[model samples]
Target: MTGRHAQHGLTLLELLVAFAIMAMSVGMIYRIMGGNARNAGELETRQRAVVLAQSLLALRDTVPEGGLQLSGESGGYRWSIHSALYDTGVAGPSVTPLHELAIVIAWDDGGRRRSLELTTLRPQRKPSPQVRK
Candidate 1:
């Protein structure tokens, strides 16, 4: 044969273009992954709020009537609960019965303040009838 056949390999220009495209694709994938990670973190933070709220509610249900305060932290999230005696319409000179309890959970969401509040009624005890003259 007068001339030899060219080798069946990619040209330099083709290789360069392929590399550029791959780089672009990798960058896009990394950006997407980062966004997803941020979203998952936010979801976890919200779930912590839910947990804190529920736990406070449970304590309010079980613990004796008094002031309540709790705080905790987890995975870039922090929470707190506050409880106090609330007016319940039933009032006496000495034995005023508080009726409602309030719980507030707070956290930081990307530098923004996020919070949830839950209010519950305390278990009521039957008031003994007063003797009349």
Candidate 2:
């Protein structure tokens, strides 16, 4: 019996094509996962910023008069709070003082700047006038 063994196997070109397809699929999956991770991180940062803003607003009295610019880092994020007098209103002179509070929370995301701002109006007690002779 003359040897006539038939070889059944994928050609080199076929194998190359299969590898290319697999590489493309892997690349796509990697990109999708990366995007998901980024979105999750951004969401987390936003939540943290909200909580920080609330706490800051609650403690707004700590800020000195004429407003202030405070900045710091916490939980892998950078934050800033800016307080200024938005308006004294047109109510003329009044015993009770009103202030505009603005809190700005900021952070970095993949070289992009992200921030959240919270603002409100707060009433403050007028300082007691010094007694004169």
Clash pairs, candidate 1, are none
lDDT of 1 at 5: 86
The ten-residue window of minimal lDDT in model 1 covers 59-68
- Per-residue CA lDDT of model 1 for 12-83, tens digit only, reads 999999999999999999999999999999888777877866765675554345555666775554556555
> Model 1: what TM-score?
0.52
Task: List model 2 lDDT by residue over 11-126, tens digit each.
Answer: 99999999999999999999999999988988887999899888877776643556667777777666677665545555556544566777778887778898888888776645
Highest-scoring model, TM-score: 2
lDDT values for all models = 0.70, 0.76
RMSD, candidate 2, Å? 6.1
Error of model 1, residue 121, in angstroms? 7.9
